[model samples]
Target: MYEAVFHVRGEGPYERATAESTTRIDLWCNDHCDLLSIVGDGEELVLDRIREAVGVSQRLGDGDDRLIVTSACLKQHAEGYVEQYLAAHDCLTLPPLRYENGAKVVRVLALDAANLTAFYRDVASDYAVTVESKRELPTPSVDAPLLSPDALLPALSPRQREVYRTAHEQGYFELPRETTTAEIAATVGIERRTAEHHLRRAEKKLADALVDAL
Candidate 1:
C-alpha cells in the first residue's frame, strides 16, 4: 500500500481562520469528484460553496497580494485542477506540502481479491500524484510458548501454564474473587469453555504439586 500527505498554509486576502475548512474542502473534492467534474462552461457551484466555507475573501489588489496557502493532496491524479485553482484564485498560494505538517495522507494497498498493479495504475491515472516514500514489509511471524508457572512445578503442559497464570492474575480462587472464566477467555481470545478446562487442569496440577510438597 502507498500513502501521501499534504501540508497547506494560506495567507494574503484570504481569511486564515478557515484554513482547516479549506483543507477539508479540498479533501472532499478529491473524494467526491462530482464536486469538481465539469458539467458546462464553468466550474461547479460546489467550488463556490467550498470557497465560502473556507473563507476566501474577494480578490484584492489585482490578486497581487497572494494568500500563502499550502496543502497536500494524495491520489494518482494529484495535481491538475487544484493547482489550476490555486493559480487562478490569486488569493491562494500553496508552498511545498508534507506529511509531518498535518497533511492528510491516503494509503493505497493491494488486496487479495484484486490485481495491485491494475488498481494502482487506475488510481495513478485518476489522481496522478507521487508518493513521498515507499517501503516493503515482511509477513508477520507467529510464536506459541508455554507461559504458566504451574508448568514449572511439574506434571504440567503448556496449556496448564497459561491457565495457572490466568487463575492467579484473575484471582479466580480468592475470597470475593475477581474475574470470571468468561472474562478471562475474552481477554485471551479463547472460548469460555476452553478457559474453564484450562483453569481446572492447572488447578489440579498445582494441587497435586502442593500435596507432594507437604
Candidate 2:
C-alpha cells in the first residue's frame, strides 16, 4: 500500500465557510454520518452555513459544536471539487489529520503509485493541489499484530482518547495498580466518574473494533 498527503485549495461552500468563519472545523468519517466538529467562538455561525452546504443532503447537529453531515450524492458533483474528484477516482481522503492556512489537507491512500499519479493529474486542474508527503505502507508479516495502532485508535473519541492515554501512562492497568481512577481523571482534567465512564467505553470500543476486525 502507498499513501500521499495533499493540500488542496478547494472551491465550495464547505471550504469557503471554513475560510470565512473564525472557528476551526475538523471532520471525521463514521458509519452513519460524517462528523464535523467546530471550535472557537464563531462555531454557531460557521455551522449554520455548513448545514446549508451545497453537497449536503441531510444533516444533524449536536447544537454545540458538532454537525453530522450526510452527502449521499457526492459522486454526482462536478469534478472540480476535491472531494468529488476523489470520489470519482475511487481514492480515499484521510484527514482531519492535518491543518493549514488556506487549503484542505488530506492524505490519500492508493494500492499503487500509478493510481495516485492519475488522481493528481485529474485533480490538479480543479484546485491548487500539492503533494506534501509520500510513503509506502508495510505489508504485515505473520508475526505482526493483526491491526495497526492507527486503525484501532480511531475507535476512541478525542476526549476518551485523553483518558485512555492518561490511564496507560499512569499505569492504571498494571498488576498492582500504580494509578487510581481519580488520578486518571485528574490527569485528563475530567471528573472522576466521567473519566471512568469514558475509559471503560473507550476500552470496550477498542476491543470490539480491533478484536473483531482481526
Candidate 3:
C-alpha cells in the first residue's frame, strides 16, 4: 500500500479563509453536512462567515474554539471537491481533513503507486496541489492493531514536544517544507535558535528510541 500527503489550495472556503488567517479547522464530512472543530483567533467572524456561506445547525464549546455542525454538506457545496474522484481512482482519504493557511492537508491511501499518481493528477487539474510526502506502507495483517503515537514515541519534555510537534504539523519535515524554522519559532513564541535546538534534541531522542526498538 502507498500513503501520500498532499497540500491542496484554492479548493474550498475554509481553505481560503484559513490561508488568510491563523485559525485552524479540522473537518469530518458525511453526505449530510460537515462537523468542524475550529481553533485559534477570529472564531466569531469565521463562524459568521460559515453561517452565511452554508448555515450552522449547531454550535458547541466556547470562546475562539468550537465544534460546529453545518446545515449543508460542504463536499457537495465546494466545486473543487474530489471525494468522488478519489473513490473512482481507488484512493481513500484518511481523516480528519486539516485546513490551515489557505490549504487542505490530507493523507490518502492507495493500493498501488499508479492509482495514487492518477488520483493526484486528477485533483491537480483543478486545484493547486503539492505532494508533501509519499511512501509505501507494509500491508498490515488482519490481526494487527492500529498504530498510535504513544506506542511509537518515548516520553519527551513538554517544550521539546511542543517545538517538534509544531514543526512537524506545519510540514517542516516535508520534502518541500511548507514552513521555516523562523516561522515555527514565531508560532510557538520562541527564538529560532531555541526552537531548532529543541527540535534537534527531540528528533535525536525519537530516532534513538525507534532505532533501539528495531
Candidate 4:
C-alpha cells in the first residue's frame, strides 16, 4: 500500500487552539462516523468519521493568525480529500509534508494501488475543514525474515518471520518478559490481532518442529 502524509500551516483566529483542538475534533469525527448507519465498511467509516469529527464549525475573526495541519494516509484518494478539505476551509497555504525518522517507520500493506488510494480519499474528505498543507508518503517494507532459529524457519512466511524476530529481540521468552503482545504489535506496525496470529502460527510451527527433532 502507498502512504502519504500532508502538512498544513495557516494563520487565523483559531491558529493557537487548532493543534490540540484538531486532534479532539478528529476523535469526535471518528466517533460520529462509527455511529453512522449508511457508512459501510469499518475502515472506511472510521476514516470518514475522523474527518467529519474534525470538520466542525470554527468562527474566525478579522484578526490574522496562522495554523498548520498534517495528514497521513494510504496512496489512493487521500490527497483528493486533503485538497477538498483545504478548499472547503479556505485554508491559506497548501504544501507537501514529509515524515523522516532515519530508519524505522510504519508500513501499510494494501492489495493494490487502487485500494490504497481509496483509503486515502476517504480520510481526506472527512477532515476538510482544518487541513492546510498535505503530502503523500511512500510505504516502507520490512525485509527481515520472520522465522525462528529452529528448523521451522523454512515454513514461516515473511510476516511470521517478523513476528518471530520481534518476539526474540524483545525477549518474549525470557523469565520476566520485556514486551507484551501489544508492544510487539506496535513494533511490527501490525494490529494486535495480526500480531497475535503471526505469533501463534510461529509458535505452533516451532513446537511441531521441536517434536520432530526429538
**Candidate whose lDDT is highest:** 3
lDDT of 3 by residue, 1-214 (tens): 8988888887467876676565777888866988988865557666876886688999998854589999987766677466766887999987778787788878888998999999999888988899988888888787985343433665443466688889999999999999999999999998999888778767887898889767
Candidate 2 local lDDT, 15-101, one digit each (tens) = 565566434456665534455655433555565665555334444545323444646322233234666666767677664532223
Clashes of each: 16, 0, 3, 34
Candidate 1 accuracy as TM-score? 0.28
Ranked candidates, highest TM-score first: 3, 2, 4, 1
TM-score, model 3 to reference:
0.67
| Pairwise lDDT winner, candidates 1 and 3 | 3
Clashing pairs in 3: 18-102, 19-101, 19-102
Candidate 3 residue-wise lDDT at 200: 79
After superposition, which runs of candidate 2 have C-alpha atoms over 4 Å from their true positions? 28-33, 54-80, 83-90, 95-102, 140-214
On TM-score, the leading prediction is 3
- Decide which is better by lDDT, 2 or 3: 3
Q: In candidate 3, where is summed lDDT lowest over 10 consecutive residues?
A: 146-155
Tell me the lDDT of model 4 at 56. 22
**Relative to the true structure, how large is the alpha-carbon lDDT of every model?**
0.38, 0.63, 0.78, 0.40
Instruction: Give one digit per residue, the lDDT tens place, for model 1 in 161-184.
Output: 566687778887789889788988
Give the lDDT of residue 92 in candidate 2.
74
Residue ranges of candidate 4 with Cα displaced over 4 Å: 1-154
Q: What is the lDDT of residue 131 in candidate 2?
A: 87
Tell me the TM-score of model 2: 0.50
